[model samples]
Structure formats: C-alpha cells, structure tokens
Target: MAANESADGSLRAPEDFRSSTCGDTKSLKKSHLACRGAVAIAAISLITAIILSSILFAIWGAAREEDPTFQNKQTENLQQCQKQCEDLKMMLHLATQDSRCRLCPEGWLWWRRHCYFFSVGLQENRRWKESAEFCQEHNSSLVEIKDDAEMDFLQGVMCNATKFPFLWVGLTDSQQEGRWLWLSGKDIQDHLPLVVQWDSDDRDCADLRGDGTLFAADCEEYGPWACKRES
Candidate 1:
C-alpha cells in the first residue's frame, strides 16, 4: 500500500488528501481572523463607553459643586428685587400723601403757587365792583396778574373756558382818568402795557376778552369775573 492509502485496503490519492488538508487549514485561518476582528471591535466599543461615562460623571460632579452657589445667587437677586419693589411702593405712598395735602380745593384750579376760580358757571354776570365783592366772599380776590406770564395763563384759561364776551379782571382807571391801576394798588407799568384797546368813550374798567385782548369797558357793564388766591 502506498503511504497515503487507508489501512482497510482502500487506495487514497496524495493530491486529493493534500487538497483537503489545505482547504481545512485556510478555513481555520479565516475563522481565527474573524474572531480577532470581533474581539478588537468589542474592546474599542467598551473603551468608548467608559470614556463617555467618565466625561458625564465629571460634568455631573462639577455641576453638583456649583449648585449651592448658583442657588444662593439666584435667591439673593430675587430678594434684592423684592426689596426694591417694596421701597418704590413706600415712596409712592408717601408722595401720594404729600400731594393730597397740597392739592387745590374743590372747584378751584391750581397753577404755579396759587389757586384760581373762574365765575363763568358760578353766578350771573356782575359789575366790576360787584365782582370784586363776590371774590371777597370766597376768601379770594380779583385776580391780580403779576406778569405777562400770569396774563397769558389767564388768557389761555379764558379761551378754553366759555363763550362769554368778556370777564372782569382787577384792573381799572376809575380813580383817575388816563391812569390805570391793578387791584393791588400797583400802578400799571408803562413798559408792561399789553395791547390794550381803549374805548373811545370814557371807560374805566378793563375786561379780558376770549380772544386774549384787553378791552377798556365801562365799570357798570355786567360780566363774569376771575378770582385768585394762594394755594
């Protein structure tokens, strides 16, 4: 028998036996390479998972360390905001009280540092002298215009108030012709003379027209009036 033949007397070819042994060897090598590749992949995956878990744990640890400080800062800011709001509320309450104490009386208009009353809706028209008495009854006086500013304010008020022809003011030349004087006994300054349209007739009293013009009217003429007093 040849060295490659089976012991039972069956003949075996050397070429065929060699071919089968080479095929089995190649399959074993392929299986070993596949198993090595799978092991390498599993190792890489495990390493990646460990690295990610370590990063996550580090971030969580740092956040935990800062949590109390962040919470305290937030609470401090909230408390400051609440304190500021309380201060503003207190200031507003005090200001309201102060304003109420200084407010003008009912039926009176406050301007600058004085209170004023317009007689448009109060009573029937009165003569210039009667108008002065009516203002006295209210503990006020016929409005004594201090400057052009006061005159302008009064004119604006009259312009917006009513359609009455004119309102009596505290100005007159009844004591002497050609010599005008305010109710306060201050001589009408020549420099302060506004566009006074004097009457051709012998008129003494001055009235404010809705057009903001001053007209010399007779003292006996009946008209509404304005009064003024300190606030």
Candidate 2:
C-alpha cells in the first residue's frame, strides 16, 4: 500500500507542472494577437491620411485652372456691351437727319448725311491746298478722313478709274514737313494713308499716285484731284 501511494504522488506532481506550462503558453499567444491588431490599426490610419491629402491637392489644382477662363469670359462680355452702346448712338443721329436734309446732287454719293464727289476727269494736278480751293469753288472742301473703313472705301473708288493716272489727294505736310494736318486742322500725321511706295525724306507733299494710292509728291506738279462736300 505504501509503494502505490508514493507512485501516485509522483504522477500528480508531473501532471501539475504540465498544467502550469500550458497556462503560460496560452498567455503568450494572447499577447501576440493583441500586438498584431495594434499594428494593423496604425497601418490603416496612415493609408487614410494619404488618401485625404491627394484629394485636397487635386481640388487646389482644378481651381487654379478655372480662374483665367472665368476672367477671359468677363472681358468678352464687357467688349460686347461697349459695341452695343456705340451702335445706339449712331442710330439716334440717323433718326434726326430727316428734319434738316435735302437730296444730294448728281454724281455725288450720300453717306452718313454727307455727300462725296470724285473728280476723276479733272486734268490739273495741283497742291493739296489748291485742291481744297477747287472744291470750295463748288462749295466744298477736301475729303475728310472719318474712319478706317471710309478711307479704305475711298481708296477702292480711286482705284476703279483708269482715266486719271494720278490725282492730288487732300493730304500734305506743306504747313509743317513730316507733320501732316488735314484740311479740318486735325492732326493727320497718325492717320496718313499708307503709301505703297514710300518716298525719300525730301518729298514732303502728298498726292494720289497713278496706282490710285497716296504718295509724297512735288508741290508744283500737275495731277487730277479729289473733292468733297456736305449735303
């Protein structure tokens, strides 16, 4: 009976030791699992921050691109408004013309309540001032340049005539060389017609060349000339 009791006590001690070791292993495994979960949560937070930063950067870039486009559209709208205002003023002037006007003479083209005459057959080429006097003989003056399109239209009319090789245009620097003043006393140096053949420095006078274009000419030379009048 004593031998049996001793063997049973030894077996019980070994069994108790195995149970304590198993409990320690289970505690270590639980700690490892908790550490892995913490690491995974940190990684997920880092990814979310990166995604938000990318979205913000894209929004800022898109706003920068749109700014210039919006300003360009606004400028276009302002220009259109200015053009409409000018057209309205012209229409009002036209409406008032009937109360104070009569028919223009023959051989004269009527435009903007004024009459323009082209003396194509006149043979005498005179100085610009002399041409102005010739037009005054018929109660008129030298042609006045109103705008770019009007000047271009006058150039086209002069070009059509084959009979007059050249004419004295009402543009000259006789009063002040290199400084052209129109008959209306408006500074025409800036608005002087473009010369197809530019002259040397000594040629200060202006005349319409044979090609139906304006050029500097000798004041004493003779050529056909243009005249203008108001209706």
Candidate 3:
C-alpha cells in the first residue's frame, strides 16, 4: 500500500510542473505580440506625419506660383493697350498731313527740313532710269525714307490713297534683285515702304500706287512715282 501511494504522488507532481511551464510560455507569447503591435503603430504614425508635411509644402508652393502682382494679367493687357494707342496716334498724324498736303500740290512736302512727294500723277511712266531723269528735271530724285516716323507717316498716307494707280518711288533693286538700294546710295534697311504685291526678281524699279505706299513693278510699266529732295 505504501509503494503505490508514493508512485501516485510522484506522477501528480510531474503533471503540476508541466502545467506551470505551459502557463509561462503563453504569457511570454502575449507580451511579444503586444510589443510588435506597438512597433507597427509607431511606424504608421511616422509615415502619416511625413505625408502630411509633404502635402503642406506642396500647397504653399502652389500658392506662391499663383501670386497676382508677380504674374499679373492686367500688366500684360496694359502694355498691349499702350502700344496700340501709340500706333493710333501715329496714324492720326499721317491722315491729317495727307489732307493738308493735298492743298499745296507742289513737287514735294516740305516738313521738318525734308521734301516728300508721291509721283503717281506724273505725265508718263518710264523705266527706273527714265524716272530718275524726270525727277532730275524737277531738281529732285526719288524719295528716301529717313526715319521711323517718316516711314510710318508714308505708310499711313499710302494706306489712305486710292489703290489701283501706281506711283514711282525712290527705292529700287536696279543694282540687284532682293538687294534694295535707295536713291541715297545706301542699302535699303528693313524699315522702308513695303507694298502688298511685290514685284518679281526681274522688276527692279519701285513704284507707288495711288494708295501712297511703294511697290516694285516692271520698269516699262506706266505708273506714278514719288520724288524727294533735301529741304
């Protein structure tokens, strides 16, 4: 009887030890899971903070780009308006001069120490060489444009004149086509009178239609012209 009791007691003690070991292992596992959850939460919070900061920075940059004073639409519009006003003023001056100059009906316009004339009403249309002679007969040669105001004035005058009749002008490519030479013997700059219908390469002489601007035409064509002399 005593030996049986001892064996039973020893088996009970071993079972109790195993239960305690199992309980300790479960507690350790629960602590490890809690630590992992805390680490994950910290990582998520850091990422969210970074994302929010980036969004704020982007919004600030966009606002700066849209600033009104630095990128003002009104300023651009005002500049365009000013330029148009200047052009209109110049046109008005030319129109007034055109009307006043007609009363004189002289060889050239004497203004600001210069002479200007549109030769479209001359008696005959001749080659460029012949037109030069005709101008010489009047103690003047073909007209020369000296400055921007003069060119603008001439453009405005020609635009106002009748379109079909041709006038002789001072500019010609007599020396070389595409290389315009004025009566002043200087290369014609880009600022000279430009007609809508330019002459072909073979047509070196410049003539003005009744419209007042100069155009290139065949030297033999009968047309009016412009002549100028120093005032």
Q: Which candidate wins on TM-score?
A: 1
Q: Give the alpha carbon lDDT tens digit for every residue of 93-201 in model 1.
A: 5544442343344566879977787766645567789889866765668877778788788878876765556778888888887677888887767436654577544
Q: Model 1 lDDT vs. the true structure?
A: 0.65
Query: Cα RMSD (Å) between model 1 and the true structure?
Result: 48.0
Alpha carbon lDDT of residue 104, candidate 3?
A: 20
Model 3, 1-231: lDDT tens per residue? 001223333222233322322234345446545555555554555455556556555555566467756335444544554555555555545544542223122445666655565543323345567667766665568766677677666666667766425456677777777777777787666554454357687688776544445566777655545666543
Worst 10 residues of 2 by lDDT: 1-10
Off by over 4 Å in 1: 1-100, 200-202
lDDT of every model, 2 decimals: 0.65, 0.54, 0.55
Clashes by residue pair, model 1: none
Who is ahead in lDDT, 2 or 3? 3
lDDT of prediction 3: 0.55
* Residue 75 lDDT, candidate 2, scale 0-100: 52
